[model samples]
Target: MGAAWLGRRLDRTIHAISYDSPEDPLGRRVVVRAIERITGQPRLQRIYEAYLAARRDGDNLWQMAAEYLNLTVRYDPAALAAIPRTGPLIVVANHPYGAPDGIALGYITSQVRSDFKVMAHAVLERAEALRPYLIPINFDPTAEALRANIEAKRAALAHLAEGGAIIIYPGGGVSTAPHVFGRATDLPWKRFVGRLITTTHATVVPIFFEGQASWVFHLVSRFSETLRQAMLMREVAARIGAEITAHIGAPIPFSDLTSWTDRQALLDYLRSTVYGLDPAPQRRAA
Candidate 1:
């Protein structure tokens, strides 16, 4: 029963990626399969299977994703405990590893509050298992991203206004080289995060993931952005059974951010604050 449900969901996700249309030719379908095959479609199916099993057994989805990926997430219990239990809250983090970091966030924060939602890439919305937790933003430049993001933006604000929590990756894109000299660091964070912080008066909790993807991952990234995205699952496969460390900084109250009048300045400060959580410089060394 679970396998059947998972297959249907995967089909829907793939068709969505294909942008299903009657005029879509056989070549386009071939391209979709080729891309999917390269992007660890089989491995992702296994992960999704595990997720469905967890849902069936009434277990946590985040925990299932972590375990299936062989990721052992460790964070300071006191830091997590310090999160504001009730009120409008925005958890900002660096996007180092593509999917793992998001899963780690869900696992970490779900322990504190169940009312939080994550702002994620729009493709993830196709996963029925993940829909409840994600507020998707279309990052495709070809699409009308500003218009596409409006609904998600409104949903985030409404959630915060109701005293719910939301998580955001201010960098907007994953960290990589060339974009930040020789190092792997988040791309210049978007100013929208600052706007959300100020607008909702939400307490901001900055969290940093401790490592980067393998050298091969970054090397391929230098060639093509699309190729880099396709290699995300390969990165996950490489890190299987790896201990993923997360550092959670003290929460910054909205009052603390009010003084920063400039949008870029506010985003720069918040980026620094999150990156500051890294305990060692060598961990991110290229």
Candidate 2:
């Protein structure tokens, strides 16, 4: 009965992620289903009751996120200490696991500094759990969406100006299945990170978090991009107890970025820097 109720909303969810993952409670259905697949319906219900009780008792969304992560994620922190607790900063990373990675970033950043935000795809802005940490960018290309994006940019700049830190995924979309000649990879990053560096002169950090969704998640993309994202929604929760490796690179100053005249070269440099933390995810056969 729960699956039946969630089925249509999940279906609608797929269509939405071809563009960006929607911030919908419907998305919660996918994660809940994943948890139920392992813990059974009764236990899942108990977990929800606990969460609702927490809400009633005045627990914040971030605390709820930590509770969820305690059950599912295990990541090592390496060199994360190199990041300064107080400063204007920009951390750029590859969007390998989409939503979960954002949560990981938020959790890690909050550990270092309370005054920080992530520049995220606008759809993620809808998640009440992530609201305090997100500066959402809508990629719809429609005028309204573009306007929303502009506002997001303004906010990001203001945060940077205030000496707060921010995180950004250069790849606008989640990493797609590897191209014919490449391993699973993100689309090219926008020049926005470079622009941000130039504009704010914020310290930039490149982070590489190891791991990806299962092959099952990648296979779902063969049918539709949205479905792939939806499947990832489920897969992410099922990753409980999984080990995640996080490699943090030394920070780079804005003056260093200013010398690079070639946009492609700059992106390649950033991409290679991230891949440097570990071997790049193996590319598919050409």
In model 1, pairs of residues that clash are: none
Taking all chains together, the TM-score of candidate 2 against the true structure is: 0.75
- Give the Cα lDDT of each candidate: 0.78, 0.65
Worst 10 residues of 1 by lDDT: 15-24
**Candidate 2 on 1-286: residue-level lDDT in tens?**
7766667656664422122233335555465445434533333334445665567544445546556545343444556777888889988877777666766666666667778887877655444445777888876657888888888889988999999998888887667666322355667888777777777879888877776666766776666644554465455555544555567788888778877777667777888787676644453211
TM-score for each candidate, following the candidate numbering: 0.85, 0.75
Best candidate, TM-score-wise? Answer: 1
Displacement of residue 137 (Cα, Å) in model 2 is 1.7
Each candidate's clash count? 0, 4
> For every candidate structure, what is the RMSD over all alpha carbons to the true structure, in angstroms?
5.7, 6.1
